[model samples]
Target: MRFLGFCLSMLPIPVIQQAGLALDRHLGDKAFEAQLEELWSAISTANDLVSKVSTLEEAIQEIAKTIEASPTLEAKTSEFIASLGSNQKEFSVLTENQSYQELRSSIVHADISNFVAIGGSTNVIQNSTVNSERTHLHATDNSKNFVDGTTFQGSGGAVSMRKITTQGQISVQGSGIGFGGEGGIGFGGGSSISFGGNSNEVSGNCPSCNELLRMDKRELHKYIHVQCHKCKSTFPFKLPNA
Candidate 1:
């Protein structure tokens, strides 16, 4: 079922809607119809279209009703996309069953300016300057936050469970910044600076139990193995020179 959703999510919205409409017209089994509805809901949420469409099934119904009533569908879609850009941000309210894969892909492709995800697991932020105040303000996931020439700036901008992988440069500046979470990773190939008064930290999760392992930046040089108190398991870590 997950694989089906994965494949369908990659299809163009128009194609999916057409397939759904065809099924609606020809299919009759209630069980099969229910399954198709569930799949549509999952795909809609995954594609970050739930905000525009409460459910793909509903959207298809609306399309059926409007297909003959209008001829400017392309213009409407364009206007919708343009309006989203006006906010200069992408936001999602996710449940535990959801991941941020589709949304992350959008960020990477579109160079999205800001993002916010609430209550989702395995969230990722990459290849863009994410507003610290907006991204994952309240969520617990095995998050991997990357800074490829990106800055996680602002007061109260604390990234937990983060493995700062620098490709260009990363700066975790501001007071009251701390790191602690389940799992994290960021990719880059440049120098990183962690300063601005009490703001030098690193963290990652245990491979065995996914428990958070955190430490101050000063202790990174001597750091070799991180032990998870929850599972009594240890993992090796190689720190970049801070």
Candidate 2:
């Protein structure tokens, strides 16, 4: 029970002595003090109750209506104060389901120039959890997954974009975790990237017999339909990017 200290009346009465002596005669000491305490107590109690309740709209509003119908400032003040207190508690209850945690891990610094961000807007996740009540964690689970379990927003991921070297061909090698465009494999920049498991991108040097031709990932599957001019007469091989 926090005591709301007495507020001196803001109205400027004659400061000489006791200007309200006449009015004091009207309301006896016991009656005035008791009435003030009653109003204060009611307001404070309402405030406490509202905060604890799951739903405060009905209860607080009822108190407000009761105060409005009353024809005095003291009653209105009590109701307003009660409403304020109750609201703090009420909203706290509503957000009880929410959780907060600080993940403890070291930051990563890596070069990610090779990776490209695909076209279109990305998912804006307010919060994410793994196997928790909410639903899913974005990016961590799969590069393919986007907002609300929907497909990419216009192929919206590193899988769609590819960076062209100033004067070098894009290379690939079919090995661990497959390949597409290296996620976060740039000349310099530590941006997190995730590529598809099997991307169909092929490359080869033109006309230079001594030059190299290469393919990786799903291309490793037998009988590659390579649409390249220099590599052929259609040369068949395995583990080029390797």
Candidate 3:
């Protein structure tokens, strides 16, 4: 019995199951039942270990895939950064080019032959010369007023100028109408009398009492003092060439 136990212990555990079954058939079931139960328990533990090892192998494969794609992701990131740097360098070169510098320093001359501006305010400041055939500005917006103050020493051609505001009074005061040329008339070519709207009539409200002051053709080119009838506050009203 001692020799049998020593020999069975020396054998592997898997073989021990078959050997114990054979011994049970030969000798009896009573002597080898505990050894068979222990062998079965060892087999269950080995099967569990095999299942855990299979799961561990799948996890290792996923980690290997991630590691293999890391270089591709890093390369794409580097390529994106390099593209931004290249675009910035190209933009810097374009801004520093000779043509770009010339465009920044060049003079812009716009030839507006026949121009008509309606419904807004326009300001023209000519230091040297302004040659125009006909220039007309009409302010149709009720919320704004048209105001023109031009001072020129010389002119080139005939200019028929007309400025009208829809809901505001027109104020024109300057030197001579035309400068340095014959028939260079200004502000309705000396035919217009009142200056407000297209109706050739000018009217305004008193600043003190809000009374309406209407201008007739007699009061067109005259420096007159108007008194508000409501509040009797007198104010000076002047016209061009008066």
Candidate 4:
């Protein structure tokens, strides 16, 4: 029994050496290794936390920027609040809708008159007065206005040039008539016929008369019998052979 106990206590050289190595490995360096591992784990956890927080903070800031940038949301919210607080109807009102449309239209279509350019001479004034179609005002030195077409004109631009005037006369006389109509005719701007105080014949007759009367070849041919409507007188208008 004693020998067995002593043998057990001494043990084998390989077993003893292995035991010492295990002790050194487990007890001696274990504290430092554990401490290093613990510190590394803590540092890793802290880094992860920091990364998560930074990501969260960036997300939050982005959300705030998005909110700030959204005009429709803010404007709608404000309008809703205003409507709720005021006497505004929940439904659309004509005036409000019109105002909204007008505001949007004004924003979209801003007038820029400076971009517009007016042509022609500024030295010559624009004639706003209405003129007869028969008359045309020129921009010459006299600004000579001429009646182009035949117009039975009295006054008030009734094809009489009572409206617009350049620098010359109120109504200019025309040259001649053209085409055919009810004792009246009109043509393009090129042709003209006009009347004045002196052009009017005052023989004091209604249907008037053609002053030029000459014997034509029709009266000399055969024995041409003609009856006058005024006197009912029948007369042979044939000339005797010489």
lDDT of candidates 1 onward, in order: 0.36, 0.27, 0.31, 0.25
Per-residue alpha-carbon lDDT of candidate 3 for residues 28-47, written as tens digits (9 for 90 to 100): 54434555344334333433
Task: List pairs with backbone clashes in candidate 3.
Answer: none
Which 10 residues in a row give candidate 2 its minimum summed lDDT? Answer: 87-96
Best by lDDT: 1
lDDT of 2 by residue, 110-226 (tens): 111111112211222111111111111112112222211111111122211222111111211111112222322223222233433223334556342444543333324545443
Report lDDT (Cα) of residue 140, candidate 4. Answer: 25
Backbone clash total, candidate 2: 6
What is the alpha-carbon lDDT for the whole of candidate 2? 0.27
Q: Which portions of model 4 show Cα errors greater than 4 Å? A: 1-176, 179-216, 219-223, 240-242
Candidate 4, residue 139: lDDT = 27
Error of 4 at 126 (Å): 44
159: Cα error in model 1, Å: 10
Each candidate structure's TM-score, on Cα atoms with residue i matched to residue i, is 0.24, 0.17, 0.17, 0.14
**Reference-based TM-score, model 4:** 0.14
- Candidate order by lDDT, highest to lowest? 1, 3, 2, 4
The local lDDT score (0 to 100) that residue 150 gets in candidate 1 is 37
